[model samples]
Target: MSDPVTFALTVLALLLGAAVLTALFSGAKALTSVAHVPLVIACGLSALLAIFLVSKVAGADTPQFVSAPVTWFAAGKFAANFTIAVDPLSAMMLAMITFIATFIAVFSSGYMRGEHGEPDAGYVRYFAVMSLFVFCMCGLVLANNFLLLVGFWEGVGLCSYLLVGYYYDKPSAAAAARKAFLVTRLGDTGFLLGIMLLWKLGGWHTDLTALFDHIAKNPPPTEQITAACLLLFCGAVGKSAQFPLYVWLPDAMEGPTPVSALIHAATMVTAGVYLVARCAPLFALAPDAQAVVAWAGGITALLAAFIALAQTDLKRVLAYSTVSQLGFMFLALGTLGAVSPVFAVVAAMFHLFTHAFFKALLFLASGSVMHAMGNVIDMRRFGGLRTVMPTTHLTFLCGAAALAGLPLLSGFWSKDLVLESLQFGAHSGHPHAGSFYLLMLVAMLTAGLTAFYTFRAYFLTFWGPTVVPEEAGHHAHESPSVMTVPLIVLAAGALFVGIVAEPFTHWFSGFVGRTPSIGLAAKLAGAAEVAHHFNWGIAGVSTLLAVGGVALAYMAYGAGGPERVPVPLAGVFALSRNKLYVDEVYEGAFVKPAEWLAVMARVFDLLLDSVSRVIAAVPRLVGVAVRPIQNGLVQFYALSMALGLAVFLSFVVFRAGR
Candidate 1:
């Protein structure tokens, strides 16, 4: 009955109610005008609750509020509970989810409206599913148990599938939905298995706090913990769109733009990072798993950035950018985990927070662009939008600068923390210093690529000659105030959120209960006294790289530049443009084999059916042959009985003779 718990319950209830109400009234035209009312009320209440919880936890030391565990099912020592907990981490995530989701909902109100300013036909359903999406994420952040988290995790996945394929009639949209669903399911299977393994190996308890306490008090074997952590990371890889499983995310752009923003920014994709953070206790015991996570993240960041460089579609560029940024977060987690487990979690969380603002801003701004341009998202066809949509142009520029990790932007602060964490690991006398150095190199290169591609998209979209398609040219104009307002708010966050980096990192580190140790890099470089100080050298290197990238982009795509700049290595550009044929590789390796197995299964099924029919015919044939023997006549029956007796006597005599 604590205030925080009460507020959280109230928030959950209101969101649940809004979801139910919207779904109930989705198909009712008469209620379309009022469908958003419940969501508005729910969002407002949730925002207030989130703020209250965050304020309560902001200054408190080790502040954690947990609801009394309600046993859902119990047999012997095995049990599952319905519980909720909010510490600084969960509270922060709750605040961001509610706050960002509220604005996105408001933006959608304007964006999803019909051409004539009426509500779209599926308007109610859109709001309904969106509200449900928010509810699921809330459940996830508040969940105190693994089972609950998994439930909410799958709930968000289901909602994403629903929202992504909202336009069911569009073949691409439907396919994208299925792709996202099946691909994530692959990781989800691993996640589920990990949970089961943890339960079996550690204890029967599924409560996260309890499980962490158990694992910490009585540490398990390295192999067991490592296997569990790796399994859990598989889910993260799929959900966050890491290498090999990342193909689904770019295609997910087929959904409505708001849905895309939600996925990329606030909700599903970030779940993997949160999972790792939540399970830091486990990962701390599994160094091998931690290395795998870090390597996967680093590799993904570089690969996705390269792909983004060659993408022509606005959303696809952003999608790949999201994948790359997520990789950066994982890399931070992995590197820090090696040097300081607590710092790794904090660093990753910091990036996740900043990324939410800038990435969401970028997506919404792109939506605004699409709105004005009659849904044309091809950057090749867009140019000089700054002259027409100044507000959107400025807001989008803020987002782009932040994403590029320009000095003082939100991304600069977070991304540097990641790099610094790597530096700490490289010089911390860890056995894997060489590997950390290699990761750092890749991360630095990815940063340059990020800046290059982001501004490349920006310059192509807003700075060149005004050259929109003829069909959309006449209609290009600023988006409505509703949509632009969110952009402005998010842009402000992207610009100013970096200022709180020190306080936020300090608070988060304390909350997680582990302070990062100073690495040997400061000592080796003869700056041990200022080891805790900001690494100006690292910052300078990253900034120069970013500047160099932006300059290169300008030279290539700025006003009056070449129609198509000749790539130095045309084959490399071609490969990048084709996503290095990763999809084709998967199709040939996995998909084709799966399809062949399915065909073989179908042929086996047909053969089995034919054999079964042949076996079945014998009984039918016997029945048909014996049908005439059952004649209805008392005299015939008596004669048949007498003949039978005579045959029996004959048979008995023959047997005795034998």
Candidate 2:
């Protein structure tokens, strides 16, 4: 009963209890309100526990805590156990999840309140699901073994499906939930296969620590390791909304804004990034798999950024931005892993840490704006909101700046580290240098695009004449203190989290396990040196790109610019607006074929039914033909028997003659 273990289990219990209480009281108003008390208390306690664990981890040189394993089940050479492990990485993630979730819960208390300031009927359900989601994310982060990780991974996915379709009566919301589930399920399938492969390789050992140690001591074949890594990364791709499987995320905006914030910022989306970082040891053995991850991330970053540029819905624009930002994280992981495994893992986790704060702020701020505009998220319909919602505007601007990677903001430090990693990879003379160089160029371009769309949404929403739609009524005002306070807190983080980038990186290096190679370690040290020195050339270029993007946005959408531009590049605009027709392409390729298959299946089903009917008719026909033979009259039976006997005798005589 160590303090750390006690605290960890206590946190888990509190969250589980919160979820259960809310579920139980969902139908009773007074009881539901009482239930929320425990929910908030659980959130607060979890945050405090997270802080304690993070402090303990950061203060110690060797920060590892593992609970005594409790066997859940056992079989020959195979067993599942319940265990919790906390190290620097998991500690940091736990801190971030609980902390952000606390604020979101507090903010939701206001945002989800009824018109008269009472809790809504569904409020209890929302908090219940939210609490459950927190528990699942914690489980995923703190799991000592891959089995628990996968279980919690699916748990979070299920919670997301429930939360996203919270408004089940809304057709769009229901459809979005299904889409998210099905799309991510595709990746989970690959993840499951990878797990099985690893389990077999390790002789049924699935404990992550033991598994990694085995792989490091006796490295598997290149082909096997590469295949496993690729399969595992497929889950990351879908969960994090990478290329090909990213269609679900944009549509997921149909959920409540708090759910969006949670998904994008603190919980579900981040699970993928965490998964890759957690398995950095396995990936280090497979360079080919790392390269695939790098390319997929780079391309997704560019593609999603371009798509964001033409989006009009405020939340949808941010939704695409999240996809692009996630791509950058993977790019960092991929490039750096190939050249410098330790730094790559650190850099990826760093970006994930910083992204949670700013992205959450942005989404919540958008929710505020939507509230004032009669729930209208279309940027084309509203303008000049700064005067009415100054707090929201300022907070959103801060978040937007950070997202754009403007110098000195949280995004700049982490994103610059990623870009510098790519540069180092290209120069490291690795076999993958050419691809690394190409990816670096793509990442840099995506940086500029990121800036453009972020500010584009900002300018169009807050600048120009105040054009509140008539349908919204006359009173557009600042959100209540409950909502505004979270914005302020998150805005401060967005502004200052970059300041600790160096120390954070150094600290993170200690937690990602051992370096795979001395050569790789040397390269990583060099990358760290470059980052420490703050390469002015790289910073200057990135800052210029960011500023140039903002300037271009201002020119096009600022007060003096045309309210509606009549651009001549209609085709390009159309393509960007249509998300480069990726959805359409998927519809044609996968959806249509599946539909055709379904139709063919139906035809086969019908034909089988018809054949079954024909087969069934023979029994009925025989029964009908023999119906009169079963009459209960004794005389009739005797007469029929006599006639049958006579006929039988005639047949016998004829047969004998023949």
Candidate 3:
């Protein structure tokens, strides 16, 4: 009902509707350069809407939900409503979705320039779907109730499937799309169950406010609460691409780079973090549930980080890195719920913000490289690119520094808060504190792994000798300004976020809480470790690990001095290049098992047929057996019928007769 909500929702509707209209009319322009105008305008407007919400109302109170119940279904004294809301959380997410969509839109202006062809149908289609994806994500985040959220979630998931397979003609893209959708569905099923369980809790309370109120009044059975948490986490694990559910993401690079950047890096994956943070109050009441969520999140983070250590493909490495960072956000939320619920939520939100910028920058920078280098992502095949693509190289370097948590980078500040959240966990009740300690240790291990892989990626792609393939010889150059502009903007964001993170943390603290303990320990630990060990502790260790990884790559590839790639590191390079066969393990464990099940489906069908055939024979056999009794004994049958009728009537009439 407020101005911000009305403006935001109206703009979203206008964007979507305008896009559809433009797409229809676009066919008349022979689908020329002008087709992009509508899309760019919509994206810009969307950004304006988001900024208005963020600047004017993100810190403001939640708006009362306004709904006109469109009858989705009516059955047996119940009706399903297509309800919507503009709460504080939804407003935040709405702003984020639109903002990222705008950046990606601007980047696409250059990245997808030559992609347009005769008829331009495909390009037009791309814009349409992209707009829908934004719409669905915004709608999902703003839904006041579970039913609406589920609908919106499914829409976003489907849009992701479409976007990931944007180059549908490519076998790789198609495969990746299928893989992503199927795996995510595994989690969505649980998400659906969680919704159902919530709906049924205390007699069909599906509205978020109503559900929370009921939970406050009559806390759910522990088993039900645990199941709800796990189910919701099923969606989280799949969306965030954590551990066993993570394989589809790296392969998703088969899509266009911008597609990968938008869906995997900037937007979709962070939905899980938003979900957990939104429900912090409910999770706070269930410590065991929180523990499960925290443990799963922590384990997932460590697994992905270790795997990232071995990757060689530039985008693939970043893909896994996204998964790992998301896991850290989850870990923070899951652990800090009871002790510092607000801090956990704020930290998670902040991490989500910083990660979006850096990760998207990383992907776009890689796109610039691929654009110049004949679509090659094999970092071992590149060298001395700083001279060739200065703008891109330098911008990417800044992005990497952010990702590696280097000082004064957005990643450093956000990542520090996440780490400190674990320490907060450690000082809770003794049992909780002990659990948090182990979790923090694992998270720290992930930090080391993060540095190792990020640097490995940087070194192979940027440093080392000039080993450009013959076809790629002397063709590399700076990308057009359109792409670099977004990269520079994002890089600046990444740099500035860290320096001002304290104030931002303070601002978000009003919604969550300012984390005094995390800041204390973070500063203390860094200073202490630096004083005790290297002149630089966390930063020093991280930089050294990164440099060491680069050095290792150099020895293994290059033959030239000071710029040598690794020749000896070739064989052992499989450790990093093959991602340590972790993807293979995932295929064997989950993928292969699913395949095996599919293979046995025919046998299962045959067994089912056998049972069905026997069931069919039973009815016939019973009918035949009874048919003999109905033969020509009519008088006898009539006598029996009369006797039965008399008894039946007597029993029925007894009370009336009396």
Candidate 4:
């Protein structure tokens, strides 16, 4: 009986209200102490509401009424509206985001507590910002118009800045926050310009559904369309941390692990994937743009996977893994010219859904490891923790296996779809079929890299002799129930969600394909028919790659071997370990130049200030010369007047003589 719009709004209200209330009482110790309680409740209800909305949309034969348009503002030809809209795509995002956030909130209750089981100083602030993040992400997916979506996009960015810098006193955390903000803004700038271009091309319609209809009715030039879509994707490149823009995500680990889990898995980073998928109609018209996306994603996947292989920091490995997995999603999306846009988007989103679970599990599990190791995440610092932290080890194993794309797990099912999409693209007889084939090869290689690094981190941390780091003292133990329970729940999702949303039945694809924009795009492109079936051969190949990588990892590290570089491969290992010098390149190439410019600007400012001071000195000199006449003393004033009269008489006599 609940209206989709109302339910969506209610969920947003609950989260936003939680943020407001918590912030209002942040000074009250009693209230601040239990901030996570309100967050859990709000997020729990949000999950329920999201579920209701998803079911309602999934069951509807036609597009359900999500919102009634209300104009918020109007310019000469463009307008922005305050409207909520939900298609199957947004509904699925809503369900996944809210559910994952609920459990994360529960985990934070224990994770944010100080070492003595007391609420930390920023406990309230953390929950408040977290609540705001969920609210922004929900708004982003549900907004009916591009302008509204962009607003929420930046809102989430702000929330990330706050949460990532929760430990503001630490230089690293503060720098990470700034890096995340500034780097993503680089993409956001492109995104905003792309939207403006779209608006102009589509008769100035800002509403998504309307804009798509307008563009289709009167298609713009192919070159313009390509430019707009590519520009928009530039935003995705920045926000999603693709290739050249991916440096900030690894450093983002400077924040609390819970925040890292939320941003990397469930919220901020996923926004880019969601944005691209949301605009599938626009992308379908731009094959060149799609090819760029495919190439960029492919390179990013392989690049990040390679870097992850040599990382000793457990969270950093996972961070690079997150980047690689995101590349897989982009790769699926990039198959537009060779595959149905609807199919491509559905495949991409399916991976997004499945990846969220295990990635969150991996991150939270790492947090558990950090907890037991006295906050040290370095793999070489301690080993053989299988017995010391049994529950953590088990949960982390589940997550690692899932991330490695082991058969029958969530990752396996979704990864198979990604590979299948690429395979289909390569043979689709499109002009770019050869390029698609090349990307498929890169993707397969990346898969092996993914599996290798994931389990490499796993084995190094949990499979060695029970060596506890000095940081852990002698009391290393499993995390508290509050944390482990979420792990169990998330681990279950990571293990089974793919099957539950199985592709064979077209359950996941059908639900997402029902998204109105996707349907509109398919109709516009004349590719309305769904043709993909599960490819056993693709599945077999991917499974082999995953298994091969895992085997290699076991041979290298499963026996608790010392971390060492082979003499011949030392050069390779060093390159990967140094993250291919991407950061160093940026430092020398971008950061240093920018820093020098800032220094130059500072010098310019000081010179201008000195010039102004010199100019002002003239006035001061004039004042000093006239000061004797203006003195407050009566005698000084009279003497000055008499002297002035004498000078006036002398001047008159001199003039007469002349």
Using all chains and alpha carbons, the TM-scores for the candidates as numbered come to 0.95, 0.93, 0.82, 0.94
Candidate 1 overall Cα lDDT vs. reference? 0.84
| Total backbone collisions, model 4 | 2
* lDDT per residue as tens, model 4, 110-162: 99986789898899999999999999999999998998888898999999899
Candidate with more favorable, higher TM-score: 3 or 4:
4
| Ranked candidates (TM-score, high to low) | 1, 4, 2, 3
Error of 1 at 172 (Å): 0.5
The residue ranges of model 2 lying beyond 4 angstroms of the native Cα positions read 33-35, 501-532, 560-562, 566-569, 631-658
Q: Candidate 2: give the clashing pairs.
A: none
List per-candidate RMSD values in Å.
3.7, 3.0, 8.5, 2.9
Alpha-carbon runs more than 4 Å astray in model 1: 75-77, 501-532, 560-563, 632-635, 651-658
What residue pairs clash in candidate 4, if any at all?
A: 384-464, 384-465
C-alpha lDDT of all candidate models, in order: 0.84, 0.83, 0.71, 0.88
lDDT of 1 by residue, 1-658 (tens): 4478887888889899999999899667788867777776788779888888877776565477789989977788677899998777788788888888888888888999866689887889889998999899999988989998999999999999999999999999999999999999999999999999999766776888777767766778889988999999999999999987999999999988999888766678999998887777777777788788999999999999999998889999999999999999999878644566656666788889889999999999999998888888988777899988999999999999999999999899888888988888787655566799999999999999999999999999999677667757576888889899989999999998766655345544454332111121112112222123468999999999899899988888787222474767577778889999999999999999999999999999999999999999999999999989788888988998999999999999999999
**Which candidate do you rate higher for lDDT, 1 or 3?**
1
Off by over 4 Å in 3: 58-72, 115-121, 470-473, 501-505, 511-573, 589-599, 603-658
TM-score of structure candidate 3: 0.82
Query: Distance from true position, residue 192, model 1, in Å?
Result: 0.7
